[model samples]
Structure formats: structure tokens, C-alpha cells
Target: MRTIVQQGTRCTALAGYVRPDTLDSALAARAKGLRVAAGCTDLFAAVRGPALSGGILDITAIPELRAISETPEHWRLGATATWSDIRLAPLPPAFDGLKAAARELGAAQVQNAGTLGGNLVNASPAADGAPCLLTLEAEVELASRRGTRRLALGDFLTGPRQTALAEDELLTAVLVPKSAAAGHGAFLKLGARRFLVISIAMAAARLDLDGGRVRHAALAVGACSATARRLPAAEAALAGARADAGLAAAITADLVVPGLSPIDDLRASADYRAAAAVTLLRRAVAGLCTGREAAA
Candidate 1:
């Protein structure tokens, strides 16, 4: 709870918190098993008591970890980049779904302070970022004193509240290949209510057209399984189909329902969640194709 500012950089040091302004310093601290923190929107909510269990390594002061930039082959979202950063970045249409997800995360304050890396680390079953990142085929970059490595977004989220992140590693950034950045994308979420509501079902979709026929499609649904999933069968069914208002017709229950294993929860029943997934996917398809993003 105390900050020391030196040469325009910040380093917070307190009873149980330390924020280092450089990657090397952060990694050295990370090696000691300090909890990694960014934004900490979920951390405070998840902690049952007034204070965190142990020491915290706050990475927000690390300059390199808060940037949003593009390289020739990919767009990099630094792990500390806020939801507002992603929503306002000069990204292509393929990021529309992600931007929409940002807007839907919470009210303005949460959008301003919540970090993308924190979302991945929390690994919530209903995380709004997962489905969108899955559609983009994003990869998370992890760094530790040992070295840095990357994992495909889908592979990183093992299950609800579980991930492939290592104890000694810091999630440095998320990489989106320029190859998947060519098409338009959209997102849809069905919540009990609008503001601050956990999704019962959500879907993210991206589509590329070739000569007025569907050349590529990426469809993913979340809050309907242990982890968000790509609807490959449904995507395959849409291949060569016309890209128009009727694009949603290709979606069928069997194609969309085969892989999900939702359980009955306080928010919604398993059957309702499964059925909502199909509707959300279809609407996401129509939203991306028609340029009128819709929500349910």
C-alpha cells in the first residue's frame, strides 16, 4: 500500500505487496512463488477474507507489459492492457468480437481497470474473453526466470478455474496472428440481466468470404462447458454456404451440441444453457455477416 516513484517508474512495496517496474525484476520475484497480480478485479472478489493469502507481485508498473502493438506477423496485447485498451485499439474488424466482449465485461470502471491477463489467469467458466480469443486463435506468452513460452488460447484454459500457467511464470502478452485478422467478427451473450451479470451462454464468431461463399468460419461458445469450445462441426457445415442473412440456417442442434457438458447451476439449468448456446452462435453468425451486432 506504499509506492515509491523513481525516474518516472512506479514500484509499490508494502507489508504483503511488491510491484516491480521491469520484467527481469518481476521474474526474479516471481521465482519465489509470489502471487501474480494485474488489475486484481477478480482477486479481491475471489478472496474470502479482507486480505490476500500471501505476498503479491503486481505487474502493472512494468512498462512493456501494458502496451498494445502490432508486428508484421501478429498483433500483441500486453498482459496488463486494460479492457478499455483493447476496446479502443486500432485493430481490424476481426477484433470486433473481442472489443464487444470488453464492453460487456462490466460497467465503465471495470472496463478501465481490468486486465486481459488477469482474465486468463482467473480462468472463469464464464470468462467473456475466452470465446473471442478462441475465435481469433490467440496465443498467450508466458515468461519466467527460466525463459518464455507460448500456448494456444484453447490449450491454456484446461477447465473452469484451471489453466496451463506455471507458478513461476508471468503471462507477458497475447498474440493474434495476422492470418486470422482478415475477417469480421461478432459476440453475443445471454445473461439473466444486462449490467454486471454472468453469462448463461455466450458465443463468438469470425467469417471470411471468398467470391460470395464462406471460405472460412470460426465459431466458439462459452459458459456451456468446462471451457469455451470451437464448434468445428458447425463451422464445417457453413463452408461454401452463402454469406448473407440466411447464414445462420446452417447451424443445427447436433452440430453445436455434441461437445458441450454444461451442469445445472443457480444462474440457469443445463438444458437451458445448452439451448441458449445454439441461439447465441446463430445470432453471432448473423451479426458478423450483416454488420449489425446483436445481443440476447
Candidate 2:
């Protein structure tokens, strides 16, 4: 961490490269309009100019922003926690969807440095984390000098490359309520080859069973919409369904098509994405019922 030069409660790091180890100092830098960055995996890649555009508020130095802790009511995933952190954490099977996405977020190096905050903040329509988190009913915590607030993950992303985060507010944590963490979850994506490829379609699902019947179901699709979205209609159909292959097979392409808004992109046709989403979602549920990994 660099020494902060405080000017009337406002702060700046060396050459304006602010790396504050404390939340207060971080907020102070943010208040000054320094770009808040963690991991910077996207930042560096998106930079086309000879040099970076401006000074950055590096939150990675803040200890509280890099932890994954659990409470009686919820699991708290700090904003700067890396993909590797989630993949390696001893979380319950309910987080299998997130862990599956975490493992395939990028190459090993990107997973080591790409953060949950960066992924959400980037707000890419195809972001793997969004579908997984959405299925888990995650909420995001935003902090500013004025106060702290939370927004459901669905409300956080407004559109492609957009979010509800205010200019002065920093995304501090992601919360998964205990109520939404009752079931096993799975994530799957289809791409041209597989490793290190951007998603053509992606799906995340969670299933909670009771007496051999599905008690709760959540299904989310990404890369097939302007923003990743949860399919409550499809979820409603899955509720009370038997936990078996037939049930999984019932998740036809039409089942999730209404919930998605896929477009014809260079990677794949919109119809293909819609169909792939259904297949992935079905496989996810099938794997859960049969006690196999969903992301085969």
C-alpha cells in the first residue's frame, strides 16, 4: 500500500495510484473520483492507449474487501475476493454453481486475479458470475461516505455495461441469504472450443428436494439476454416436480425461451443460444438429481 497524502480528509496515492488499506481511506480516494479497481484483469485488457487513462483506487489492499465470511443469516463474499478464492473456499454444495463458474471464469492466471467485484462491475452480459449469483439470490452491498446500502443482484445490473452503483459508492460485498442457500447448484456454458473461450450460452440452476420431489428451483441464463436474468416462470414449472431424468427432460427449449432475449451474434445464432440454454439448464437439473456433476 502506498502512503496517502491527505488533503483536508481527501486522499491520493503515489502519482494518484491510490491503494488504500482502510475503507475510510478508500472511500476518501473514491470521493475524489479515482477509478476504483480490484484485480484489474479487465482494466489492463481494455486499455488500448499507450498508457492508462487515470489513477485508480486499488481496493485489493483493503483486508476487509478480500474476505469470504459466513454469518448465521447469510454468506458474505467480499468485493475483491478472486475467483480462485471462491473455488477454493469450503462452501456448501449450494454454491456449486458459483464454484463451477469460478473454475471456468478464465485461465488459471485470470482466475487468480479476476475478482467478483470486477466481474459484476464490468456488467458484461455474458459474465459467468451473474447467472450463478442470480440463481443464489445474491445481493450486493454498496458503500459510500454518506452511508451503506444493498440492492438485489438482479436490480444491480441495469443493462449491458451498466449497473446501479452510484459514482461515489463502492461495491463492498455480495450477500447470499440463508433462505436461498438451501439447495445444490450447478453452472454450465457452451463455447466454440471450451477452455478460455467467451460464452455463447450459459446457465445456472439450483434445486432443493423434499421427499424425492423438488421443493425449490431457480434457473438463470446469461449470454442470452441484455443482462443475465432469472426465469421465475420456468422455476414455477419446476417446483413440486419429481426429481428424476423425466423431470429434467421436461426442461425443453421453449421452457426458458420466453425468459431470454438472445440476439444473433458472431459467436452463435440467437435461436442456437436459446436452445443451448435449455439443454444446459436441463443437464444441470439432471446432474443434481442423479448425483453427478452438472457441468459435464
Candidate 3:
């Protein structure tokens, strides 16, 4: 086993590792199959999992991959932006809620070092960032020798630890549309402990209000399904409706969709995850209400 450490942080020296500073250079270097490593948070699993299967394309030095910009049409986050970056950003409600989730990802050190792109690439069922990004209608940019393409974050992630990203592509950026930027949103996670624990269930929601009634809404639940999913029934129920305990309860019940396919794991029972996901859904909606009222 070989090891590599930079600035007191542990990384791996795999069979082949290439560090490139530009998008084109990174893409070129990745023409041959290679695993992407930004923060190296999840790369440990790749290095030690089972086999020395592939090379490494280290994109940490790519300047274009570290940008966070706000435009009239969207809030663009570089794939490499750390959880701490999102947490501290002065973003609108949609992203503010995600920032809250980022803060819960781990401890301060993890928040400072773990990258958003890494989370998306890892595509964990319990990833704190996925549900919120799904609700935001975020898009991910994938670059390779073939050129660049974009897809919704939900579409990019096919299943647990699986993504549409190819072996030679690097995730460049995450784009949150302006509509998502202005909407009121919140995220909630239920874990064994408040901090440093994988979520048993989590929910993220965004509400667009018109004259004190929700005109549009998006709701997604994580850890209760194969992938995080938007509660379309719940969203429809909340749309054009006044937010209240009654509405919250109805939405919560409707959130138990069939597609999630949650199974009993060591963390919790299937039934428990399903039930808890609904509770977190309600709380997430309530938090949005609070955020809206605070803004008002």
C-alpha cells in the first residue's frame, strides 16, 4: 500500500495519478480512464476498496473548477467548492438551506475539505447535499475528451454510488437556476446523532409563495429510496395552498412514495426510514414557512 500526504492531509498514491490545472488539460489527461479526486474524501474508498482498478485524475489545481458565481440567471458553484464554502456563502434562500445541510455534513474539518462535486460523484443514498440540489433543479457539468455536457443533478446520479459520469469525465460545476434561487427552501436530516452521523432520513423542499399561499413547491426525500425523490403528490397538494399544520400533515403522508425502495439496513428498519422521512419532510416544509415569515 502506498500513501501520499499534502499539507498534513492524507491522500493516496494510486497506480497512476495526474494533476492538471486547466479544464482542457484535465480532460486530456483523463482521456485514459481515471478516477477523479478533488477533496479525496471518498477516494479512500476507491483506493482501498478491493482492487487497484484505475488511475487518478486530480483536479484540485484546476482554477475553473473552484469558482462560485452569482448571475441574474443562476448561482453557479464550482464542483470543488467545499462544504464550508457553501455554508458561509451569502446565498439566497434556496441555497441557504443547502448551506445548512452542508454545515451538517461532518465536523469543521470535513466541511472545510469535502467538496460538493465529490458528494455528487459519490452519489450516496444518504448524502446531505443531494436532496437539496435535487429540489433546486441543479445541473451538473461533465467534461471529457468528448467535450462537455450537462444534466440535472437527479439525472446525473443513477443510483447508490453510481452516476452517469463516465470514467474519463470531470464534474466541472453545479448550476442552480434563478427560479430556485428565489424560492423559499429548507433541509432536514434525522441521524443517530445531530452531528457526524449518516442520515437515517432527510428531506429538502422549496416553496414559491404568492399572496401568502404556496404557488409552487418542490420536495425531495433522501435515504428512504434508491435515490432521493421529489414528492410530486405532496408538491401538488401544497401548491396554491396555505401552509399550516394540516397541510403539512397531509403532505407528510403523501411523501411515502413507492419508488424510493428503501430496505432495512444496519442504520434503521425500512419502515422506520419511511416514517422518519415523512417527519423530516414536514419539518423541512415548516422551516421554509419560518424562513419566508422571517423574510417578510
Candidate 4:
């Protein structure tokens, strides 16, 4: 049997990992079955699990994959852009909630190296950035030697730790549209510890109001579902309704029915996650209300 630290297949591939400096080269390598390594956080998981697995195709050195740009319609966040980049960016209102979540990602090293694309592809239900981006109705761009295609972020994630990305495709960029850019939003996360811990439950909301009537609302919850999901039912409840404790409670209850589908896990009980998920929704609504009131 292979032993850990054997410097065999898994470690050998990683140890000999080549840094491709161009997008074409990275994409070409990916076309040939090379796995891209952006922070290597998840890569380490596969390597250290006592199995000599697939090799890596290092994408961090590709300059084109790491540029964040602002456009008239939306902000384009590059796939390899670090979490620290998001935290420091003067994002528009809809993404400010995302920036808030970015601050709590992990320790400084992880934040400096962790990329938003990684979070989506890693597909951990507890990923801190997932709920924020999902709530913003973000789109993901995938590129391959063949060409490029775009998919809704929610659709891109198919299940726990799984995504729709093909082996030959690379997650190249994230696009946040203008509507989401100007919307009022908030994100709340619950965990055993404040930082560097996986979330028990999290909620993110983007709301639009006209004359005390909700014109639009987008809410998504994570850590309790197969993947982060937008709460259409809860959002519908908020629509045309005032932002008050009663409306918030109703939305919270609706979330318990559809927004979350928790199961017992080592970090938290399903019952605890179910209750906490609702509480998180309530808190996010309250926070958004407070922010809107302050701005008014």
C-alpha cells in the first residue's frame, strides 16, 4: 500500500506542478486533462487523503484569469481573483454584502489565496461566499479550448461538492448584473466559532423597496441545503410587504419549509441548523431594514 509522504503519484504531480503564464496555455493544458490548482486548498484535501490521485494544472499564474474589471452593466470578477481582492474592492450595494462575507472567509493566508471560483467549484454547502453570490444572482463563465459559455451560478452548482463544469472547462469569470449591483442586501453566517470555522447556516438577502412596498427581493440560504438556494417562496412573501418583524418571521418560516434541507452532521444537528437557518433569515432582513433606514 502507498504511504503518506511517499512522494509518489499525488505528491509527485503537485511537486512538479508547472505554472502556466497565459490563459491559452492553461486552457490548452486543461483540454489535455490537467486539473487547475488555484489556492490548492482543495487540492491538498485530495492529496493528503492517502490516495495518489490526479495531477494538477496550475492556473494561478495566468494573468488573464485574475483581473477584476468594472463594466457599465456589471462587475466582472476574474476566476483567480483572491478573497482579499473582494474584501478591498469598493463594490456596488448588491455586492457589499458579498464583501462583508469575504472578510470572514478564513485566516489571512486563506483569504489572500482563496478565489471565488474555488468556492463555487469546491461546492461546500458551508462555503461562506456561496450564499452571497447566489443571492446576488451571479453568473459564471466557463472557458475551454473549444470556446466559452456562461451559466447561472445556481445552476452551475449541481450538488454538494459538485458542479456542472466539464473536465476540459475552466471557470473563467463571474458576472454580477446591474440590477443586483444597486439592490440593498445583507449576509449573515452562523458557526461554532466566529472565524476560520465552517458555517452551520448562512443567509443572504437583496431587497428593493418602493414606497414601503417590496418591489423585489432575493434571498438565499446555505449550509442547510444540498447547495445554496434562492428562496423564491420567501422572496414572494416579502414582495409587496413591509419590512417589519412580522413579515420577517413569515419569510423565516417559509425558509424552514423550502430554503433549507438540513441533515445531521458532525458540526451541527439538523434541528439546530433548521432553527438557525430561520434565525439567520430574520437577522439578515433586520439588518437590511436597518441599513435602508440609515441611508434614508
Clashes of each: 0, 0, 1, 1
- Cα deviation of 188, candidate 3, in Å: 0.7
User: Distance (Å) between predicted and true CA of 105, model 3?
Assistant: 0.3
Tens digit of lDDT per residue, candidate 4, span 1-296? 11111110111223546567777877877887766787877667766432424456877776656777777777788888888888877666788678878888889998988888888888888888888888777999999988999999989989988999999999988988877776677888888899898888888888888886678888888898888888888888788888654567666564455556786788888888888878888788878887777777
Estimate the TM-score for candidate 1. 0.93
What would the TM-scores of all predictions be?
A: 0.93, 0.92, 0.90, 0.90
Deviation from native of the Cα of residue 88 in model 4, angstroms: 0.6
Q: Which window of 10 residues has the lowest lDDT sum in candidate 4? A: 1-10
Give the TM-score comparing model 3 with the true structure, all chains together. 0.90
State the C-alpha lDDT per candidate: 0.87, 0.86, 0.79, 0.78
Off by over 4 Å in 1: 1-9, 48-51, 292-296
What TM-score quantifies how close candidate 2 is to the native fold? 0.92
Measured over all alpha carbons after superposition, the RMSD of each candidate to the real structure, in angstroms, is 4.8, 5.4, 5.5, 7.4
Instruction: Please give the RMSD of candidate 3 to the true structure.
Output: 5.5
Reference-based TM-score, model 4 = 0.90
Local lDDT at 13 for model 1: 84
Candidate 2, 1-296: lDDT as tens digits: 22111111233368758887789988987888878788888887775454555577888877778788888788888898899989988787889999999999889999988999999999999999999999899999999999999999999999989999999889999999989998799999999877798899999999988887889999999999999999988888889988877788777766689879787889989988888999899888888988833432
Local accuracy of candidate 1 as per-residue lDDT tens digits, 1-296: 11111112478788778999999999998999888889988887777454565688999998788888888888888899899988988888999999999999998999988999999889998999999999899999999998999999999999889999898999999999999987888999999788688899999999987876789999999999989998889999999998888989789888888877776889899989889998998888887667732321
lDDT of 2 at 93: 89
Worst 10 residues of 3 by lDDT: 1-10
